[model samples]
Target: MKIAIFDISNYHYTYLYSQCKIFENDRVDFYVSKFLKKSMEKEGVLNNSNFNWIVLNDFDNKYKYYKKVIKTLNNKKYDYVFFNTLQENWLLNFYFFITVNKNIKINLTLHNINIFIKCSRKLKIKRLLRTIIRRIAFYRANSYNVYGENLKIYLEKYLMKKNINKPITGIPFSIYENIKCLNDMNNKIKIIIPGTFDLKRRNYYDIYNLLKNIKNFKFELILLGRVKKDFEEEILLEKFKKFKEVILFEEYVSEEVFDEYMRKADILLAPIIKQIEMDGVLEEYGITKETGVSFAAIRYSLPVILPKEIKVMKEIEKIALVYENFEDLIRIVTKLFDDKALIQKYTEKAKKISYTYTPLKQREKLFNELKLGR
Candidate 1:
């Protein structure tokens, strides 16, 4: 099969390319977006990346970009095309109106649905048009692949509301198989807070407060993320500097350094903030992301400590130590610190379950769901 996964940026690199490496007999290609090229240099992933990627034409305007992208993709004559990241803006639903290859089956994976589903419908007419755009984007696409289980359910309702009938499959984000199981009970338990560290989303303050209360534990707290060149964010980095326990990597970490930290750490701390709220559902539903940190922890046979309320917890229940808030997280951390057996138990559980979420497994699942694996 001639398959190509487009929008191959640094962020969505793991989900698509990780599985592509394991494909048995297939002609797989990657289409790097023009937007991703700029982000690569800005984010610092292009400096010393081992990631095998080909850059596309770096166009200044959307019209030129779409024209070139459509022509380049159409000429490939691919049987199947998977989009790693697709949303309204950054790269609009122009692909639907533009792609000339009508026979080519297109698949898309959405990171979030905040754009599609509005929090408030204050402007009634504007909401109607936004809804129409969402319908067209999903309805026109051949397959809709969601990351986590809870998100899949949410999208299902949205799809039904829009009267768009399509195949929606829930695929877990895959981890690379090369990550070795490295766990040391005697060493200080490392609790990590990774991804884009910011007040709006990650909320570094929340994690700091949690650490302040837990005084007894002998652990190193690490905050790793892209702390950009912003002045306010730099001041926030200064705050973390005061704590001896906290280690901050405020930029794009090289692959070598990242792998070293992953192996060194015992636990991953994902203090993701809840933003958008549904009418019936709790606000915590906003933080159910299948993060790269958690995926690495699972792959490396390390335990994860996440909020019990986050929707992604349900999927990682066997491997994770799910807690309510600081009160719950503090207790779990203290217990894991003291009880080596408990730590080992959860680590082993994560290793056992890690097999289920490998990129190869997800690729096979996708093929089976689409009746192409057999």
Candidate 2:
């Protein structure tokens, strides 16, 4: 089969890479931003003979870029087109409309299902039109893809409410097989936080407070995400500077470096701020939206520490340690540090779960759910 995968924002490179690997035998073309050409090349994501990497450099000239995109896709006549990221842009909605008009099968990987389903409170003209566009596309698309079964359930319930009959498929993100396991108990237990260092996404103050009172155990905090220069000085550098146990990065981290840190981590931390605003609607993590860190924990085969609010998939829930507040998080961390055996137990369970996410297994799951073979 011929497949075309699009990630206009270039934010879902990991997801795009996994799809490419899964369809290694088929003819596949990836449409990505030109800025990520070097990064894709460095990561060897374009080395397959059956794959074509098309760099889109003219996104600034929106009309010209999309015109070229539509032209290229029209000429190719692909069997499937998978959108890895969907932003709230009219141009993208127009593209979706055009793709549908062409009678080509389109699949959307919904990173935020709630944003698509929930109505905005401040329903201005732009917001209202965007909602209409999203609803039209949602009704027209062939299928939907989410990263977890729990998210699939949420999407299915929303579809039922609207009386829109559509198929929603959930598959775990594939494990990073290239990166080796590097957990070390001999040194300070490394708790790696895997997303952008932002107040909106994570609770930094709680983490700071947790680290401040750590007197009994030896632990190191790995701020794996890029810290904005402004936010860095405000929260990370100033609040976390005195502590010698934190590792900070002020710029974008390359894929290799990110995977390395995840591999070395003894435990994964996703201090999610339960309620957040997305596209003018309030949504909760693990319900309407999924956390990227949950997938990262499975990929790295490391035990994860999440809050009681964030509901994870079955495999991850088996190894996850839940915390209610700062006090709970501190106690969990201290316990993990003291009981090396507990850490090992979780890690082993995570490793066992990781096997279920192998590329072949995930590909089979996708095919069965979508009925692509027929």
Candidate 3:
């Protein structure tokens, strides 16, 4: 079972880093890219020396990078290669697959199926070409997995239309299982916002307004994760300086401090925007984009509040709260503040559910499925 999770050097801290640790065993290796960015080069970037991490060199184009990746790992003779590259390279993956290491099996995780769908629906020659490339790469893959139900559904239809019958499983992004679930019994309801404050992706404004309006409940709000460059708009939304109940860790937080926040917080607030019209990124209508933190809330035995109508909430709603608007979110929080027993119920449920997807269980399942072949 010589397995490898590849190309996580760009920005793996969100979900890729945890996947590396989850699938890691003596037989597995993390093929990290040497694409040094501020996210991984900074102080909070995870120290990946614990596992067999092989640094991969990057190239100007996808084909060159694929060639180099295959050449670099030729000596290892890996049995399975998990291609975790972003969907921006969807058009090039077919060529990469056909050209490099054809003998080896590949398990691809599509991160942006929605974006490709959006692009294909448009009536333009460029999009038509992109749609063709998208289908070819998608169907030609050895095996495929997805991060959200929405994307999984889209893949099914996309593959069906192309007359390719491939099994596409919705794989929950992995979280480190070692961290103890901290069931904090705080007097004030502490709600923490996790992940980057990307203008198009998250709703920091709603969180800010929620804090300002909710004077009846004794609570604190903490903003965690690396703030994007244009995050000043959110800062302007609510003068963070005046809010005594808010704490901001506006950078990539270390794993230690993040666990501490999880321990102290009573509930996690995930105000994910439904869609983002951007290139090279998926328009995520779900928490599956933030699967790491959402599951972290579960792993830490804390219930979470997510945006309503999110595709992932279909499963998450059983263990956490969902709200449609600010008022709805406020009412939900109010209920949690008044009902400690309910919080305990959700916490227990979260722990129970999170346990179902433990690292050993998940990796073994993935290995077995990939072994079955498409």
Candidate 4:
């Protein structure tokens, strides 16, 4: 099948494209626009033969550009068109309108729904039109794919409310097989907090304070990904600077280097603030024994720390350490550091549970559901 995959979010270069590599035999002709081109170049994965990366210089006016691009691309007669990100709601809606007018088959992959809902809130008339457009799009599209079970359920609920009948399949994100298992915990307790060091979302300052309060601990905190210089100007930096155990790698690291860090870490901390619209559900629902950071933790038999309220994460609560707040985080980390047996037990359990999320398995299920293999 000649498939055209469009990734609007561009954050998928580090995660999504790596798994897309496995679809090489599927004759997939992937196309990524928006932030993906820059991300692929930054990650040094832009030259892959299976995909074409396009950069959007005028992203502020993406709707006009998207319509033009889709019109041109659809002329090529693709068997399938996949939208890898949620912000493509407008593009997907437009695609359905145009494709329905022209009679073409299309597929959509929803990464998150909150982004579209937020956009809807801003543009009242556009929101109403888009809701009607979305219902039409759902009805016309050949297949609908969601990243997580929770998201799939949420989307289904929304669609049911709209009285739109369509099939929505939940497909977990796939992790590359190249990632090696580093089970050695002999090194110092290295913990990595990946993702943007945005104080609003990650609340890294709270973690810094938690670590600072627990001085003389042997654990090391590695802050990976982009950290704004303005963070130092903020008052939180004064407190963050006092934590000698915290090591900041402010610049974006290559996937190889990032994976190395994940392997080295004894624990992966996702101290995400509870946002009603955040993609944490994707992490909780899609994460299995074989995905990305969570999978790496499981592969290394390392324990991960997550918040207690995330409904899907509750399944792995026994293996995961849940923190109610920064104080709870400090308390848990301190206990884990002091107790070797508790750490060992959770580590083993995490690894055993993660096996269900492997790329091969996820892809197999996805292809089966899509009937693409047939």
Give the per-residue lDDT digits (tens) of candidate 1, residues 1-374: 66766673446655543445444346655557655555444445444323434545544554565566667668878676776665435335544444546666777665655544544455466555555666565555787776666676777787799787777665555554646645565877777676666665565676767677765667888776667767767887787788788888877876556667777777787766655343222233424334555566656766777666665544566776778877777788778778878877887687777777666776677677666743
Question: What's the candidate order when arranged by decreasing TM-score?
Answer: 2, 3, 1, 4
Candidates 1 and 2: which is better by lDDT? 2
lDDT of 2: 0.77
Q: For residues 1-374, could you state the per-residue lDDT of candidate 4 as single tens digits?
A: 66666665656664455446445545555555656666556655556665554545644556665666677565777666665554535656555355533445566665545433323434467556665565555556676776555566676777788786766654445443434556355656777787666765566766866776767767778876666667443566566656777777556676677767776667778776555333222222332212234444543456888766544342245576778877788888888878767777886676666665555666676677667752
lDDT of 4: 0.60
Q: Is candidate 1 or candidate 4 better by lDDT?
A: 1
lDDT of 3 by residue, 236-344 (tens): 5357657888787656777668767877777788887777654443465652243545566645656788877665544455776889888999899878888888888
User: How many clashes in each structure?
Assistant: 0, 0, 0, 2
Superposed model 2: Cα runs more than 4 Å off: 58-60, 75-77, 87-89, 99-102, 171-174, 228-236
TM-score of each: 0.79, 0.92, 0.80, 0.75
Q: What clash count does candidate 1 reach?
A: 0
Candidate 3: regions farther than 4 A off: 34-52, 57-66, 72-77, 87-95, 116-136, 148-150, 176-178, 231-238, 280-282, 287-292, 371-374
In candidate 4, list every pair of residues with a backbone clash.
289-354, 289-355
> Model 2, poorest ten-residue lDDT window?
170-179
After superposing candidate 4, which stretches have Cα over 4 Å from the reference? Answer: 34-79, 86-103, 117-140, 174-178, 181-184, 229-233, 276-301, 314-318
Measured with C-alpha atoms, the lDDT of residue 118 in candidate 2 is 76
RMSD versus native structure for model 2:
2.3
Worst 10 residues of 1 by lDDT: 279-288
Instruction: Decide which is better by TM-score, 1 or 4.
Output: 1
Compare candidates 1 and 2 on TM-score and give the better one: 2
The number of the candidate with the highest lDDT is 2
